[model samples]
Target chain A: MSSPVTTKPFETTGPGKQVLEITDLKVSFPGLFKTVQAVRSIDLNIGVGEIHGLVGESGSGKSITAMSCLGLLPDSAVVEGSVKVTGHEINGTPEKQLARLRGGGAAMIFQNPMKALNPFFSVGQQMFDVIRCHRDLSKNEIRAEAEKALQAVQLPDPHLALKKYPHQMSGGQLQRVVIAMALACRPRLLIADEPTTALDVTVQAQIITLLRALARDHDLAILFITHDLGVVASLCDRVSVMYAGEVVESGSVGDLFANPSHPYTRKLMSTVPKLGLGEQSLDFIPGQVPDMSSPPAGCAFNPRCDMATDACLQPANKVLVVSKDTDVSGKHWAACHHVTGKKPSSETALSETLEEHNA
Target chain B: MSHLDQPADLLVVNKLHKTFTTKNGVMTAIDNLSFDVKAGETVALVGESGCGKSTVATCLLGLQSSDSGEIVVEGRNLLADSKAQGKSLGRDLGIVFQNPYASLNPKMKIKAIIAEPLKTAFRLRGVELQQRIIELLAHVGLGEEHMDRYPHEFSGGQRQRIAIARALAMESKLLILDEPTAALDVSVQAQVLQLLKQLQSENGLSYLFISHDLATVEFLAQRVLVMYLGRIVEAGTVAQVFKSPRHPYTRTLLDSVPSIDPARRDELKTLGGEIPSPLNRPVGCHFAPRCPRASDRCHKDVPQEITEQGHRFSCHHPINAAEE
Candidate 1:
């Protein structure tokens, strides 16, 4: 994230505002023989305080997009493209400036707390370090601030929990502690990479609720990266469905669920298990994510899409942005060859949703 | 023999107990856990991350032994065996771990990884060995084309297929899937699970499927075992267990997985406090501490398994809300 500098452009403000804007965001890695492109010419706009879900299977370039925003990629990584957060250009900034941007612009909570946290340090000390690094405060002030953050996440007996090491806390508690650390900085934009995947379903709900409430209370933007459709359905305001290093679909939660445009997105929604839904039934897309070292031309989702046309075999059928309600509604956007007039993955999906709403 | 009176069990876990001695004290990980898995049944050990599910699986596969118990797999006692007899036990007990790439050797060829277990179980070393590897690969939804490729050549789901193939290479009666689908994508999870179901049905192999997710449990398991603090609080057919969950912990866990359709509101029961540390497992009913209906008796007396209508529960107060 270290190139030369540019001048400050504008001040970011207002409700439903764009907190993050990424233009041609590309990240690549130097493989043994050649370079591997992890992300390619991606553009995304995350609305203010709304959870923008980034959904995809592993190696779909979801994590890299988040990491690149904070300049946390490895030595082999070559990041190109612009990542602007809070009206501050990030892609080519100095490491020191990038570090400053990190807890200031957006905070991140990782997938595995056990690995993300230092095992040697206590929960309190880790929180203290993060808090003190971001803010200029006294020792007592830092301790009090950290405890308050912990309490907000509903960690019981914050003082005692603070004294305990990361290893001492349960997986669920450690995750809450991690959440507290992220919230401690009060970042304008939050990037969470599968934080709740390691926790149980009940614990997962608690964490999601904490995140949702925190978003509402603090008026911060969240980019929740996960593969679980059930989670995205309930938590995210808008979702971007990625496949093979490219986002095939992006739309409002209800619009996307009601009418999933991308074949991959449609396939993903069908896989979520529902109550009294069906047995001896499964909606599946054939094939897997292509080897990123050399991805296929045209649509990345074309290989597995059952409704894929020959046009999908071409190079330029990316995402088709659509308005749900009105002109300039900007409510929904989908990346797919076909926008309408085709049966989606499961026949009963829409009706079932309606039935649920009616009941 | 009637179903209730039948003495024959494909996998009989009797008084399985495992304790890890730390500097602080002895932690009772799996406390006198006992269950039975009939032939061709998928018994899901459903719980959060550290509720001794893996411990029980390791014991059954002979990778780890219980402190005091007997694991009878296909009529052979896994824990009772002497050193010489145990070698035969590992052959019949196959395991599929969480990460396929972690279990498999990236350096070795796919054929070699699948054949390594076969060499121990069947001693096949000639052209027969190569043929067996192809057959195993095909069983796991992978083609013969995947034979020459390395572990890194495959996707997460494909790697899992390779691991499943290797597990099946032993031709074992029991296949332990410890979060096999947890590491894969949800869409890919359905495919792998469907393939697993097909293999299990055609081969008549039993699965001791362990996972933290209850949704996956409902999908794959015929019989569900709800574990908490190293104890089985509830165990029954998936319908009997899920439709009428007797244990509060089981119900709470089910409510936790956010429903895909937002309109459906099965009020989630989030257990208020953190799951009590496994290191200091409650002496009586392990769930009593977090249980909403915890009584004085629940804190003092161990809950006995209530065997009624082909169901079993270890809760002191197993309420029948449906009847109400």
Candidate 2:
């Protein structure tokens, strides 16, 4: 099941120091008929204490990108890129070595905490096993560490909580336990793949706040993957908008939200039902996400993008939304031929459609 | 009453009570719940999981019967003659579930799936049934080309559209959309929502929109019923409920939603605790355990429903109307 391995020399840059750096990542699954291009040349970097949101519709290669970071992709996956976690190359890392790096350097919390935990085992047993696998701690020490981790997550009655099975705890409590287990190893990077999506909004807010606090307190870099634009807006310092395998836009959350450069990003932001902005007709991307096996040519979003022109048929380069002279960290980028720094006008084609529909 | 003398209210649920006898004890699923959907109106029943939102839908759909109270639809009480009125009720009501993938039959083609209700309720067959299926699909923004395709062949949004088409197959005046777009992406969700709006306007459909997403509820619903532990804690027009939420639980629920505005980062006023189990049966207000503004009275005695200009809420310590 061994795939061809590629290696690249590690290079460090900037004072913030990156915890996870993905460069020129391309992931594909070779099938009987055709190869499914899941990820196409994605470049992402998350610095210490920064929460970078990887947002996209389903089948946009978000989960694939996250899995590649941990070298957890299926054996059939043809991964070609540099996915470095805590300065360690993950693409061609040996299985034993990858296992060692997983919980120690980077830990991932999934959407469903119950599925992540073993139903048969008590929380204490699972926590002890995970802690023991990462560190050579005594039973008492492990139990103490587990209690401390649970306490850190603000789980009331940590002692009682550890004795309970996954089924016994509520959805929010189970999520906290899962988070505690992930952070027990004190990983430098946390890849939260829709961690709060399953929980209620009230519970989700608590988890979001907890994640933000954890990142700041531990100086941990987080890669928060979700389709929720609102969650990204609230939780992330920076965001990268993915569409059909390629990142169409990347910038500081404020910059992207205020002036989304890519048509996909703009349309996506507009689609989300804003809390106070009630009753306004929401804009929607017309066409479906491209089939990965035989994706549309050039910009994947061209089929659904209203602003697309003949030039959009050719692959667009990642152009800086601001002038090139801007600071590297503050620079905003959009992979579109028409990367206007300004926001789209209020009167768009969608509003026209709404008016026509109303008539 | 005759068909010509139909009431303005499409569906009226009055003091609906449903309880399940579990291994532990009898758990009240819907406790004296009352709400109404007017003709061609969208009344959203919003609450977190285990708040009996789905129970209301099930009861309305006649999948489950309530222990007491009346479910009156179009001047006929469904509870009065559930067995006799079931067939007609099926024609009047249609349901689209939360997960489109699971709700739709994968083995069946779009045409056949949509034809089921038409066949059972109207006994439509041959070209007429085919035409009706196509028409329903067209109404949902899907085309006739999709009729032969299976549920698995369509994406989530497309599948949801198909589900909506099937729900509309019987020319149902009232649709029970139970988290119809919860499983979809934001972009796709917007598409489905827009389609729903279009369908509602075009057909003069009433919708019992059940969801936990407040933003979506506000967008689609003319009125909203905020449920907690099977009780309607608050009920009002979308503007009144969302803009000036009176109940502490309603305020908490509204505040917990992470604003899409990036400037409001880290501003989430999260509720402290999870929803209490219905089996436990908290004394007094069910939301008191999680409500930030819960007073001693809230824990000691249930607050009476207070009504003001069509807005209603049960809160011991309501947030002042002056406060935003």
Candidate 3:
């Protein structure tokens, strides 16, 4: 690890600009025995006011990708390639510079609101602390700013909320306060990792609506990370499906849903039990996520993918799944040798074998 | 009341009530809750947190005795001599908790965890006990290789499978699955749900599936009960309830779930206000405070249980068929 002091300070270019840009970003954590490849080579970009969903199962490196953008990875992590936030490189940025960049250049909210907040302190004190870290303001001015931020997230009676402690409020309200704290820094980009997973459905809906509104109104780019396909479908403008540290599919939400080319993505989409679908047998990808320390040589999802062939033994390049003639921006792409641009057939030998094994 | 009146009903709860005395005052966790699960039937109890779902599970498991209720399991009243009938009750009911990581003993191997229930409940030992553990593991999609590994070695999905295996160790007629799939990923959840469905069919297992995930309930359960503030707001077949939810709370819950269909993205209507504190519930209908179509009568008088065919809902102003 090297630390270099630079005279230059980090600054954002302003709203209506590209918020985040990643090029061939790879992150690996070095351990005693072996190095865990948490994130393989992947490219992602989020523009101003764009809500990009990073959908993946556990250990697929979705959170790692987001953490890398903010330089939040541990010191053991050897992050290669470029991670630019608001046109400023963050991959090799110093801790001081990264601290300055975070909460203002980019902010993040986690799944559990209680875990994110301090139970002992009042919500007002925490908000003030977050605001003070990012900006130099007086006590009265900071309190006003905190209240304003809370109001922006649509917390009814922001004044009352400020006096209340984390335990005094409900889960939904605590989440709102956390979001407001994140927004108090006036960040251009927001990284929400499974923000609504801990919440109830009704509360999840409210939070989703709040986030969508925040992205649109505040012109904030959001990288929403979750395993729930339904949330991605409803909230995101574009989505990237990850499997075992690699993004298998990336495209507009509509395009990806209509024609999920990647076998893993298709299998994942089919697994979500849809409402009003009646009592039907759910289709599931047979195997669990591959271990990161010693993943498969070529495609990580090949073991579970029904479409896996001998060609999949080698690393697959991102192939354009959409037609060449279409003028759609962010053209549909899948990192699979067998991207047929067709929906997955219902019957497969993989599921059959799984059923037989269970039987 | 005699369970012989309904021999087919595996587990029945008649007017169950459970109250807790908190620091502030007494809290009614469950208020006159009544429902039943037939032999090999999957009856889901869906509700958000603090809705007395867990209390119902505890009461059924005899972990907590209800204030006044008859918990009948296979023509046996569980409330009667629950202390003396502990061993038999354990054989009759097995429970799978939400978090697999916390449920299992981390220090123990998979075999010991599964054997704990079997050895204590059935008093089996030696070759018979080992064989039974293997069979249970096999039933849950795990091979003999995983029998020696500790809980830490297995993944979330695999740990959940082990939990299910232990839950089935007693061959308990009714398995109380309390948010079993909530802690798992979507793909893994699918696998577990499939395993559960397959297990139910193969062994004719009755499941009192308690979950907040409506989609999974719709998939696994034949009958569904929507709970709110410790009361059964609505009950019907999956098709009937999901297709035509009459209660306002049920409608709100169904509407709140985000659809995977991208076209219906804008249809999510968030329910206003949080669940009322159980200690200080509303005067009449518990959901009246947040009900969109709450009438003056709803707040003044408790709604009677209105039954139509097999579907029942306690709502003063139920949504009409046209509204659906």
DockQ, all candidates in order: 0.45, 0.51, 0.50
Instruction: Tell me which of candidates 1 and 3 scores higher on TM-score.
Output: 3
Q: What is the TM-score of chain A in candidate 1?
A: 0.87
True contacts kept of each: 0.53, 0.81, 0.75
DockQ, candidate 3, comes to 0.50
Could you report the Cα RMSD, in angstroms, for every candidate shown? 7.4, 8.2, 8.4
Q: Residue B298 of model 2: what lDDT?
A: 81
Give one digit per residue, the lDDT tens place, for model 1 in A25-107: 88889878977888976778775677888999888999999988777888678888888887788877888988988887788
Residue-level lDDT of model 3, residues B19-91, one tens digit each, is: 9998999999999989999988899999888899989988888888799988888777878876644854578
Q: Please, what are the lDDT tens digits per residue for candidate 1 over residues B1-324?
A: 123355347888899999988988888789888898877778999988778899888777676667898877667786776662376456656789987868889899898888888897789988999899888877666778888889998877789888888888788877889999887788778888887777777877778999987777777888888899898888888887888888877777777778665333224335677677788778789888888889999999998888888788888888686642
Scanning candidate 1 chain B in windows of ten residues, the lowest lDDT window is B261-270
**Candidate 1 interface RMS:** 10.4
Docking class of 3: medium
C-alpha lDDT values of all predictions: 0.77, 0.85, 0.85
Candidate 3 lDDT (Cα, 0 to 1): 0.85
